[model samples]
Target: MSDERRSLHTENVELQRRLEGLTPLLAEKETKLIKLEQEIEILNNKLKQQIKEIENLKINLEEKLKENLKQKSEGERIEQRFKLNIETLNNELEEREFFEKVFLKIISILKSPELTETKIKSEQREASYRREEHERYQRVIDELNEQLQQTNERFERLERERNELEIKIDELRQKNDILEMELELAHDKMSQQQETSRTLEEKQRELHLQEKEHRSAQVRAQRELEALQSLSQSLANENKGLREERADLEERIGELTEMLNIRENRVKRAAELINEFLERYRLTSGRLKQQIGRQAEDCEEFDRLIQKLRQMPIPKPGLVQNLRICGRPGVPRLEK
Candidate 1:
């Protein structure tokens, strides 16, 4: 009985030792799980921040698009105004050309002696008729002068309005330039955010893989722990089984360690892949920046052309002369 008590006491000591060893392994696994959870939480926070930044970028892009649309509409309105002004100027030119032609026709009629002589009789009769015709011509000249004055006033008014419109156009151009700069800044920020998001995605994928590995390790560890518990229960009932089961548990632990090493190697390989991807991304970004620079240059050239068009001088009205006619001795003479 004493020998049996000593054997039982020894078995209890062995079980206690085994339990103590398992306690540390369980504690280490718990620490790893807690650390993984913390890492996952941190990644989640980072992802949330990235999502928020992306949303903000989207909002800014939408606003920029709206501003661009507004500017386009304003430009169209300005173009329409310019067209209308041009049409008004053309109509005024046509009216002036018509008046010039009419004046020339009147001068031709006065210069024709055959037409005047046919209408006139003797010199005394011609003189009285010529004086009456001169009064009528003077009245027509006064009327034409009044019309010319009104036309000049209208032209001056149009010129003033055109100057005002040009000032507005200049202001609009300044605003457009400001908007363009803002858009460039926004685009740069968006590019930066995209790069950050890509980095985050790679990190998230890595974390996911790590988490999956950890869960697998945890499941393997749990199974091993269950086996250890069963073996411990069997060893409590049968002393001969303890050594063999312990050896098996030690071998399983070694295998788990090897798997851990393999997992770590896989993580290193994933990191290398991430580095390669980043290198490719950097090359692509450089090319994109170069293309953006070329596009900016083209846009600047287009703006310059638009500015040149805006600065183009408007055609002014030409001066018109009063009609004068000189006739033969038998005919009447008219002067302006």
Candidate 2:
């Protein structure tokens, strides 16, 4: 009985020692949990900021897209107007060519002396009519010259407008290139953010698991503490049979301690890994932020470039000479 009481007392002392050791470990775990929670809160705040940034980026992209669509529509309208002007000019050129051919034919007929030699009264009458026709031709030639001058002026105006449109088109193309580059950068940033979010989610999940495990361990420790308290309360009455039971309980406690040590090591390793991941994430996020800032600057520069392009002067078309239709006096103009 004395030996059994001594063993029981020793078991109680060892249990107390283990309980004291576990208390500090639990406290340390609680400290770590709180620290982790604080860190998670910080990460959450960062995530929220990142989300806001993404939203702003989306808004900017939408505005840029709308601007691009508006520009494209305007460009199309300009192109259609240019096409109509070119067709009108082509038709005018064709009309001028036809009039030139007619003029050449009239001159050729006038140069044919055989018509004068025919000596028929009809021929003489025809000759008189031909002289009248020549005077009418002179009037027609003067009208053609006036028309030509007007057409030349119109052509010059159209050419100047076309040149201006071409310059605008080239500038639009450059803007498109800049927009495409900006879009690519935005896409890259979005991808990076997504990747970072995924990493954060994974880390959050790991933290949740660790919290669960810690809670379970805390519950188990509480249960063990309660059992030890009950055993202590019943020690006087049950001391005879408790020798073997105390040895088994001590063995179990040792096993629990070993398990806890293993768990602590695992927790340490997990914490190290988490810290490493956080460091990497921090570096990556910093780089992404810098990139985003640079992209914003680039966008601003692109806008400035667009404004400069808009302010640039367009080239004007010079006047072109009219097609000469009259020949030297008494000579026929040859049609090529």
Candidate 3:
């Protein structure tokens, strides 16, 4: 039971360590989740800003197109006025022929390849500027799309990681609950162990007391055995005197009957003493009871009879010579 308790304690300590270890990991996961959410928020703001910039770019492009259309209309008006001036020059040339060379010079200057090339270059520059503007806007849109895609990917990854972290958190919570239950079980086991220990202690005390009592009974049985053996020896010695009175034994039959009655009374008293001992104490020793029973069977009545015989008048010397008391002569604590 103690070993089991130690193992329980060790497991509890290990679980506590695991719990402590997981606490920091859980906190770190939560921090990462928070950071991911913040990053997502930042990306959303950036996207909004990019969308606003696109709106501004569209507005600017519309204004630029309107300005270009106005410039185109003004150019058309100038070209028409130049054509009317050319018609007036042609009429004057036909009428006078004097200004024809100056008019031709003006027309040649107006029709010069350098001027046409310069006009084409200016139109190409305008077209190139518009193309560059469109390309610039397209590049910005592409960049924003790329950034959005990247943000989406990051969001997906963060969401997956967050799901994993949540699962880990749930598992940790379950483990914590299981550990707490195990701790409760361990506490209950410890309580049961304490109870068992107390019960065992009580049993040990009871056994100790029983053993002490058994030892005491054994001592008493030994003393009784010794007393019975001594009494048997005394009776054996008295048997010789009794035999010596063989000639008078027939005449003393009545007296012998009285002595037999006394012996019977002694037997009854010894039985009563054995019953008293049994009734007064718990006797669990089989060997002690057996030894006592054997000794009682041997001389149950004689030892007690010897005790009372000392108080009686001595038999006549001729018939009962050498009759004597035993074992300190006069102690009367004969429990038979």
Candidate 4:
């Protein structure tokens, strides 16, 4: 019985030692569970912060997109307005040309008489002069045509530039669309989060930076649009002034042409008067020649008559008695 009791006591002691070892192991497991829970909480907080940051980024992106769209619209409106003004200027130029052509025709007709006296030697010379005048007129027409062509080309180029700008705007719109989709997904993810930090201060800082950049971009775009508008306005004013100057030059040219025509006509009339005077002098010279011939004949007859009178003898008393005796005595001289 004693041996049995001793064996039972030794087994009891061994069991107590094993129980004590198990107690420390259980305590360690509990500690690990608590640590794991704390780690999970930390990870959850970090995930919430990331989601909030993503949401804020999305908002900034949307605002920037809207700003860009607004800028693009304004630019388009300005471009359209500029194009309309250019068209108006072109129309004015066309009208001015029409009036100038009519004035030139009138001047040409008024000056035709001056050209009539030119000694065009042959049909070829006449044709050549006509051709030269025609070529000069053609040159003026060609220059006007060239100006019109250049204007048209400029208009076309501007239109193409506008098209390119539109295309760029479309591309920006597409990018914004994609960014919006991404932003939507991020918002959905944030909504699913179980917990989130109230003060997204770090995210707000990022958003503020983005907002600042977007605003700066907007200001730049606005300035560019304003500059373009100013350029268009200045161009329109310059074009109008140029048109006025052109009109004035045309008027001056027309007046000078008319004056030249008047001078040419006066010169032609003076030449005709001179020719008439020359003919009158020639007729007077012919009459003087006939009178000189008649006077020469009269002088010859007077000289012969004077010579016959001188040859006749001087009448004396004896001469008279001899002449009477020579005549027959029956002459009735008995009264003597």
Q: Which candidate should be chosen as best, given lDDT against the real structure?
A: 3
Candidate 4 residue 22 C-alpha distance from true site, Å: 2.2
Q: Model 1: how large is the Cα RMSD against the reference?
A: 49.6
The runs of at least 3 residues in candidate 2 whose Cα sits more than 4 Å from the true structure, single-residue gaps closed, are: 1-135, 232-336
lDDT tens per residue, model 2, 156-270: 5555554554555565456556555555555555565556555555655654565455445434533443453343334323323433444534443344344434433443444
C-alpha lDDT of residue 48 in model 2: 56
lDDT of each: 0.47, 0.47, 0.50, 0.46
Tell me which residue pairs clash in candidate 3.
Answer: none
Worst 10 residues of 4 by lDDT: 327-336
User: Across residues 1-336, which tens digit of lDDT does each residue of candidate 1 receive?
Assistant: 223323433443444445455556556555555555555565555555555555555565566556555655655665566556556655755765676567557656775676565434443464565457556655655665565556556555555554554555565456556555555555555565556555555655654565455445434533443453354334333323322444533443344334434433443443343334334532343343333344334334333433442353432223113323344432222233
Give the higher-TM-score candidate: 1 or 4. 1
Q: How well does candidate 3 score on lDDT at residue 66? A: 59
Model 2 root mean square deviation, Cα atoms: 46.0
Model 2: pairs clashing at backbone N, Cα or C within 3 Å: none
lDDT of 3: 0.50
Question: Could you tell which candidate, 2 or 4, scores higher by lDDT?
Answer: 2
